[model samples]
Target chain A: MKVEQILHMIGGVGGNSYANNSKLQEKAILKTKPMVEEAISDICNTIHTNNIVVADLGCSSGPNTLLVLSHISNAIEKHYCQYNRKQPEIQYFFNDLPSNDFNSIFQLLMLYEEQLRENKAADYVNLYAVGLPGSFYGRLFPTKTVHFFHSSYSLMWLTQVPQGLDEKNCAQLNKGNIYIADASSSIVYHLYLNQFKKDFSKFLRSRSKELIFGGKMVLSFLGRKNSPAFGDIFNFWSLLADALNSMISEGLVEEAKVNTFNLPFYAPLMEEVKSIIEMEGSFHVGQTQTFESNWDPFDDSTDNFVINSTLSGQNVAKYIRAVLEPLLISHFGDDIIEDLFSRYAQNIARHISIEKAKIVVLILVLKLKE
Target chain B: MKVEQILHMIGGVGGNSYANNSKLQEKAILKTKPMVEEAISDICNTIHTNNIVVADLGCSSGPNTLLVLSHISNAIEKHYCQYNRKQPEIQYFFNDLPSNDFNSIFQLLMLYEEQLRENKAADYVNLYAVGLPGSFYGRLFPTKTVHFFHSSYSLMWLTQVPQGLDEKNCAQLNKGNIYIADASSSIVYHLYLNQFKKDFSKFLRSRSKELIFGGKMVLSFLGRKNSPAFGDIFNFWSLLADALNSMISEGLVEEAKVNTFNLPFYAPLMEEVKSIIEMEGSFHVGQTQTFESNWDPFDDSTDNFVINSTLSGQNVAKYIRAVLEPLLISHFGDDIIEDLFSRYAQNIARHISIEKAKIVVLILVLKLKE
Candidate 1:
C-alpha cells in the first residue's frame, strides 16, 4: 500500500498497538514553542477576519495535536488580550495522512475543550476543529481558506521514493543501502535531491494557493545547517544500512531489495530551504534558524523512563524503529526486522559511546508577501 | 484488552487497512434516507440561530457519514430558500465512539466539501465539521452549544451490558444467547429493560444539558412492534446463539463463554419508548414512527447489490458480523468466529427462506418545551 496508509497504521506511541513513538516529536515541539507563539501573533496581527483559520499540516493526532491547538488558541487569545480586543473565533484544521489516528485526535480535542472550559479560557476564544486528511504535496483546502499553518518533522518526507531509484526503474544504484550515504552512487544522490526539489516546490505551490495573502506558516523539520550533505543526519541511517548489509550475506535480505529501498525523506539545509521558498513558493522567509539537537533527545538521565536500559544505542534504535519500522517492513519482509534492528542498535551503541549523533533542525517563519 | 480499545484498533476496512466494514451500514442508511430528510426538515422549521450547531450522535465514518451530512446541509438550505430567510452557517459535530474510523470520515469529508464547492453549493452553507469522539450517554459539548441532534441505528446499544448479568455477577443470567429471547428468563428480560431505561435516560439528560431549551433531537433505532416482547427483535440474536450452541457440540467454543457474552443492545416497542421518554427525558415526543424493514433489507431483488450471493441468511449474518465482529472477537477467541458465522448463515438461511425475518425500527422526533 501507500506510505500514507502505512504511516496511519503504525503511527502513535509507547502503546503496544498502532501508537507512533512520538516522545521525540514532543521534545522538538517543546523547543519550538516560542516560534509557535510568534507565528500565532504574526497571523493575528495580519488577519482581520471575524474567524481565524489555522491549519497544522501533517498533524498527527493524539496529545501533540491537542497541545498544538492549545498553544495556538492561547497565543491568539493573548494577542487580543494585550490589545483589549476580542479574540476572533478559531477554526483549527488538523491535516494528516488519510490513515492518521483521527479518533484519538477528536477524542483528545473533546478533553482539551473541557480543560479550556474548566480554566475559563474557552469563552475568550470560540474554537472549532476538524481533521483534514491528505498529502501536503498538493492542494487540500480551498483558496484563501487558511490564514496560518504549523508543521514540524513532517515536510522532510518527500512525495515518494525518488522515481528512478526504485529497483523496478533502475538497477538498485544505491547498492546495499536504503538511504543517502557518502558511498552511494552520484546518480542515487541526484535522484533523491531532484525528488526533494519537486516535492518541496509542489508543497509550496499548494500552500500558496490555500493561504490568504497575509497568511503565515511556521515549519520546523529535520535539516542540515551548513549543507544538506551533513553526515550526522545520515549516521543513523548509515548504521541501519550497515545492519541490513550484514543480513545480505546471511540471505536474510536481498541486496537488490536493500538498494531499491530509499526513504522518502530529505533533510534540507537552511540555504536550500530559503532558495526553494524564494523560487517555488509565493511566500518570503521572515526568519530562519537552525537548532542543533542531540540525536537522542531523551538521553537525559531525568527522562530515562522511555529508554530504561543502560544502552543508549538500543534506546535510540527503538525510537528510530517506531518511525522507520513500517517503511522497512514494507520493503523487506517482517522476518528480517528483529535481527536487523538488533544489529543496528548494537552498532549505534558502539558509535554513540564515543560520539553521540547530532541533528540540526531548520525552523522557518514565512510570510505571504504576494 | 478491553473490547472498546480493541474495537478502536481493528475497526474500518478497505485497501488501506483498519477501515470499518460498513457496507451493511450503507444499506440501512439508504433505507432510512427519507426519514433523515424528514427529521432535518422538522428541526430547521423550528430552530433559528446565527449558526446552526447540529450533532449527529453515533455517526459512523465513511460514505454514510458524508451522506448524512449532505442530506442535513441540503435540508437546512432548502428550508432557508423556501422561507426566504438568510441561511445560517452550519457547524456539524459528528459524535461516535472513540474507536470509530474518523480518519476515513475526515478524508471523505474533504472530498465531499470539494464536490460541494464544485457544485457551487459551498456558498449556500458555511459548513464546518468536527468529530466528537465519546459515548453519547455523556456530555460531549458545551451547554446550549448544539441546537439539534440526529442518531440512527444507534442507541440500541446500551451504555454497557446490564450490571448483574455478567458470568461473574450472576449465573450467566441469559445463558445460551447473547440477547433477550423467549428462552431467556424473566430476570434477563428485566435486566435489559432496566439497563435500556438507564442508558436512554442518561442519554437524554446529557443531551438536554448540551442543547438549548428549544433544541430538537431525532432518533431511529432497532425496536419491536406492538411491544418489547415481540420475539422478532430477538430472533436474530437467537439464530446467532444457535450457531454458538452448535459449536459446543464440536468443542470449538466454551458453552459458558457464549452464555456469559450477551450483546450490549436492546430493541424496544413504541409504548415502552414513550413510557421511558415521559419518565426520564425532558423532551416530548413530537412524532413517532416504526419502519418495518426485512431482517434483511436486501431481501428484495432490487436491493441485491448489498448481499449479492443469493443467500439472504448469509447476507444478514455478514451485516451483523460487520458491526459485532470486533466485540465478538474480543469476547470469543478469533478461532471460532468464522465457523460460528458460517453456521449462523446456514441457520438464518433456513429461517429466512421459510419467512423473511423482519425488523421494526422506531424513529422519534423529540422537542424540549421552553
Candidate 2:
C-alpha cells in the first residue's frame, strides 16, 4: 500500500483535525526536548565531529519536529562554543507519510527563522531542514550518510489488517464479538515481524554502508512487554467491531464499505524489537529504556493531561476510532456514531484520570560499527 | 509428636499405599535408575574416592527404600566395574518419621541380603541403613560425612495443618470445599514457607557442613505453579469436615478429635526451591527437572485397588468417622455410616479416574562446594 493511503487508514494528522491542532503539537515538542538533548549528546560523543546529520522519521507536520530539531541545533552550538571551535553544519530531515501536512511543517520552520537568526551561535550552526515523505522502513537516505535516526510512536502502525474477516476461522467468535481468529492473528503478527525485520535490516545495512565508522542511531517507539494477542487491546476493539457489525446486521449502515477498511498498524513488544536488532547485528546496543505516558485529559489531573496530551493528543481520536468504531456500531448502532463520540467524550470526562492510559515507549541507542 | 501418633493421623498407610508399598516402590526404583546412573556418573567424575555416604530423606517404610538403596548400590558397583577399580565403601541411611513401619523395612533388607551376597559387591558396599526418628530439618548426620542425599514425594507436606480454625475469613464464610478461608489460607501458606525456609536452610547448612566437597543431592517433590488460597482446598475439605461435624452434632458418634493431623505434602515450585538453595549458597546447582505422575487409577488399564487401598483405606475409615458420620447422623440418621461407606466406595469405583489425580514432581540436583 502507498504510505499516504496507510496513513489515512490509520487516521494520522490528515484524518484527525483535533490531533493535528498546533496546541497539541507544541506540547509534544516541549515534552521531546529532553530526549533530543540526550540523543544529540550521545551522537556527538560517538562521532567526535562538529557536523551532524539527524532525521526524525514520521515527523508529521507540527511544531514538535522543529522543537526537537532546535534542541539538537542548540546542543551542537553549545559544544562548539565550549571548544572554541566553529559550529558544525547540521542537515535535518523531517520524514512522514506523503499525506502528512508538510505545509504546516514549512510554516513552523518560518515561525522559528527569526529565533534561529538571533542566536549568534546560529552563524556557526548551518541548519538545513527538508521533508522526506516515505515509509521509514525502506531507504529514505543514502547508505551510512546519516549520523542519527529517530522515530517515536510511528513503527506500531501495521501495513494493513489481515483479510477474509467474514469467513469462519478467519475470525474468533466469542460472546457477541468477532476477533481476528488465531490463525489470522498469528499470520498478521508474523507478517508484521517479517516486514519490520526486512525494513530494519535494510535500514541498518544501508547505515552500515553510508555512515562513518563511529556514527550512532537512536530510535524510540511504542512497544509492549509481550506479544499482542487478539485478546488484549484488540479484544476491546473487537467488542467495538462487533458493535459495528451488529449495526450493519440491523441495517444501520453500509456493510461493504465497513469491510473494506482495516487498521494500518502493529505495536510489537520491546523484546521482539530488540531481537530483530540483535539478530541483524548491525549496531551495538548502547542503552534501552521503556516508559509510560498518561494521555487522557477527561479524568486525569490537569498536569498529566497537559503533559501527555502534548505527546499523544493528536493520536487519541484516531486510536479510539480505529479501536472503538466497530464496537460502537455493533452495540449502539451506526446512527449513533455522533452520539457514541459524545458518549466517548463523556466517558473520558468521567474516567480519564492522569496516567490512566499507559503507553510503553522503548528507546534504543545504538553505536554504528566502523 | 511420636512418629506412631503422626502415622495414625496420616491414616496409617492404609488408604494411599502406593506412596508406601512394594510394587510401586519397585516401579519408582526402576523408573529412576537412569537418573541415578547419570547422577552417579556426574558425582564420580568430580570425586575420585571409592567411598560414599548417601542418605534418603523421608524414606517411607517397606520395600521402596530397599529398592532405591539397591539402585544406589548398583550404580556404585557399575562405576567401579567400568573403571576396573574397587567398589565404593557405601553407607546408606534410610530416614523417615519414627512411626514408619521399620519392621517392613527390616524385612526388605533381609530379602536383599542373599542378592547382595551373590553379587559379592556387599563387602565393597558397606550399607548402613538407619531410621531418622525426628524432623529432617534439624541436624540428622555428622558434618563432612555425607556424599549423596536424595528425597522424593516428601517436601509437600506442611509441618502441620495451618492452625487457627474457626477464624472468620472468606474461605470460612463460603465454606468452600478443599479451600481454607483467604486470610487463614495465606497465613497457612506463609507459615509453610517460613517453616520450609527455616527447616530447609538448617537442613542445607547441616548438610553442607556434613557433606564432603563435590557431594551430590537430588530432591523430588510435588509443587504448584501458582499458590491457591487455603479456602479453595479447605472449602473442599471443610465440606467433608462439616459433614463429620454434623454427625457429631447429631450424636451418632463420639466427639471426633483431629489433633496431630498433617496435611499431605507437595514440594514448592522449582524456582522456589532453587531460590532457597541459591540463598544458602552451600551448594551449586547441577540440574533440575519436573515430572508429572498419574495419581488417579480409574484411567489405568490395571486395577489400582491394591495401591489405592494401601494409601486411602485407612483414610477412608477416618473420613467416614470425621465427615460422613456427622453428616449422615444429622441428615440421614444413626445407621448410615456403613451404608454411606459402601455407597462412597461404589461411587469412587465408578467415578475415580486416573486422570483426575495427576501430580507434578520437581527434581533438583545440587553439588556441595569444595
Candidate 3:
C-alpha cells in the first residue's frame, strides 16, 4: 500500500485517538524548544519582511499541532520584545498528508484564537493559520516564499515502503518481521536504509526550493544512537512481530500475511542522518542533539528502571497504537488489531520487567544555504 | 446559536449532501464564467509577478469548489496563451466556515491532480490548493497578497440572524415566518437590511486589506431585481414558514420554537446592493448583471409552466435541505427535519402549480480602488 495514502494518526478526540496519546511526541517538541526559539530569532533578524510564512510539516491534528504554532509565536513575541522591533505578521501553514485530520486542527484554531485574545493585547502578533494538505516529499509552496519551517516526529515516515523487498519467486527479504530486526537479513536493512536516504534527500531538496535563502528549519524525529541497524528502536517492531507470530501459531492469522507486511518507517542512526543531509547539499546543519526517551512516556526516570512494568507496557502500547493502528488496519484489516495489540502489551510487560527499553530522538536546526 | 458555528451545507457524500444537490449553485457559477475570465485577464495584465494568489471565499466542499478553481486556472491559461506570456504559478485558497466538509475537498483534490497529470504536459500552470477555514466576515490573509477573489451564492448569509429580532416580553418581529415575508413588519425588513449592510461592508473592508491595490473581485449572490422588501425571493421562505406553521398546529413542533427561529439570510434588491458597494468606498464597481433562475432547478422551461410539479417540488426541496438541514437541526432538533422538508416540498408543489416560482441572482465584478 502507498504510505502517503494510509499513513495518518488516529483522528478525533476519542479514547484511542492520537490527540489523547501524543504525550511521547510532545516531549520531543518540548525538548527542542530552545532550538526552535533560536531558529525563529535567526529568521526574524535575517528576513526583513514584515510577513513571515511558517509551516509545520506533517502536523497531525490535536493540541500538539497548535503547540508547535505557540512555540514559534512565543519565540517571535520574545524576539521582537528583546530586540525592540515591530512585530511582524505571521501566516502559519499546517501541512500533512491529504488524509490527515485537518478538521481537528481547524477546530483547535478557534479555541487558540479565543485564548490569544484573552491573553494578549492589541499589539500582539497578527497570526493567520491555514491547513495545507500534501506530502512534504514533494514541493508544497511557491519558490523562496516560506521563511521558517518546523517538523516534529514526522520525517521517519518513508514516501513508500522499500521496493525490491518482494522479489519474484523469492521469499520476502524481511520475513517474520515488520521492520529491521535481528532475524532480518542484511539485505533487508540496506533496503530500508536506501529508502530513507532517498526520501530524506528528496524532502531536503523540496524544502530548499520552497524556503528563501537563509530560511531556517527545526526538525525532530526518532533515530538511533549507534550505527548498527538493529538498535533499541527495533524492539518496538520485534514485540509487535512476536504478537503476530503467536497469533500465526494459534492459526488465528496467516504466516504469509506477517511475512508480507512491513512498516514504511526507518529509525536511522544519527551518523546516517547527518551523512544524508550533507550529501543533499542544500542545508547547513546548525545545531544537533541526540537524547533518549523512555518507551513509556509516563516513565521519566534518569536511571534504567521500569517501575510498574505492566502499566508502563500498556502506556507504550497505547501510544504506539495511536500512531500505527490506522496503517495496520489498512493492511491487516480490523479483526486482528485488538488481539495483536493485547498480546503485544503482554510481551512488552514481560520484556521490560527484565530490562528497560528506550527510544532515541534526534533534533536538528538547519538553514538553507545561500 | 452563532451563525458561523451552525451554518454549513450538509456534509459528506450522503443522500442529503450538498455535493449531490448543488446544480442551482453550479448554474450560477457557469453563468458568471465570463466575468471570472475577464477578472483573471485583468489581474494577469496588471500584476507583474509570476506568482498570483486567488481566494474563493465560502467555498463549501464538493465539485463546485473545484469548479471555481478550474474556471480561474482556465482563465489564467487562456490569458497567458493569448498574451504570449509565461504561465504564472497560482496559489488557490479555498475559504469556508470551520464546520464545512473540507475533507471531501481534499479527497477530491487527489483526483484533480491525477487528472491534470494525465491531461496536460509539465508546462501547465502550477496550482497549489490550500484550505483556509474561518468566517469570511473577518480578515483571512496577509496585507496586499491576494490578487483576485471570487464568492458565489454565499454572501446572502448574514453574519447573524439580525440581532435584536427577539426582545424581552415583546412579540417576535417576523412572527409566523422564517424570513422577510409579505406579512413581515417594516421593522423586520429594516432589521434584516441593516444586518446585510453591516456584514457586506465589513466583508469589503477585510478583503480590501488582503487584496493588492487594483486587484479584482467577482461576487454573485441571491438578490432581487426591484427595490422592495417582499420580492420574488419571499416565496421560498413563505413556503418554508407555512410548512413550519403546519407542524406547529399538528403538535409536531412548538409555537415558541417556530416564532424564535429566523433564517440568517437576506436577498437585497439591486438598488440596495449597488448603494452598499458605493458606500463601502474601497471598490470600483466594474460589471453588474441580474438574472432569474427557476426555483425548481430542474425546470429549464422559459415560460411560467410547471410540468410535473411534484418532481420539481421534491428537487427544489432537496436542494434547499442540502443547505439548511444542519442549521435547522441545530435549532429545532433532528426529530423535525425529515417531516419539515417533506411538508415544505408539498407546500412548494401546491404553490408552483398555480404560478411558477423563481429566484433572482445578482452578479458583480469590482476592482479594489487604487
Best by DockQ: 3
Model 2 chain A is weakest, by summed lDDT over 10 consecutive residues, at A3-12
Candidate 3: deviation at residue A328, Å? 1.0
- Per-residue CA lDDT of candidate 2, range B72-135, in tens? 8778778878988766566566665544544345445645754766777543324434334334
* CAPRI-style grade of the A/B interface in model 2: incorrect
Which is superior by DockQ, 1 or 2?
1
Error of 2 at B32 (Å): 91
| lDDT of candidate 1 at residue B146, scale 0 to 100 | 75
Local error of candidate 1 at residue B16 (angstroms): 19
Q: How close is candidate 1 to the true structure, as a TM-score?
A: 0.69
RMSD of 3: 1.5
Q: Estimate TM-scores for all models.
A: 0.69, 0.41, 0.98
Query: In order, how many clashes per candidate?
Result: 9, 68, 0
Q: TM-score chain B for all models.
A: 0.90, 0.71, 0.98
lDDT of 2 at B344: 42
Candidate ranking under lDDT, highest first, comes to: 3, 1, 2
lDDT of 2 by residue, A120-152 (tens): 554332665555554555445543457777666
Listed in order, the DockQ scores are 0.21, 0.00, 0.68
Q: Show the lowest summed lDDT stretch of 10 residues, model 1 chain B.
A: B301-310
What would the per-residue lDDT of candidate 3 be over residues A168-263, giving only the tens digit for each residue? 233467778888898888888899999999999999998998898768999999988866766678888899999999999999898888887888
- Sorting all predicted structures by DockQ, with the top scorer first, yields 3, 1, 2
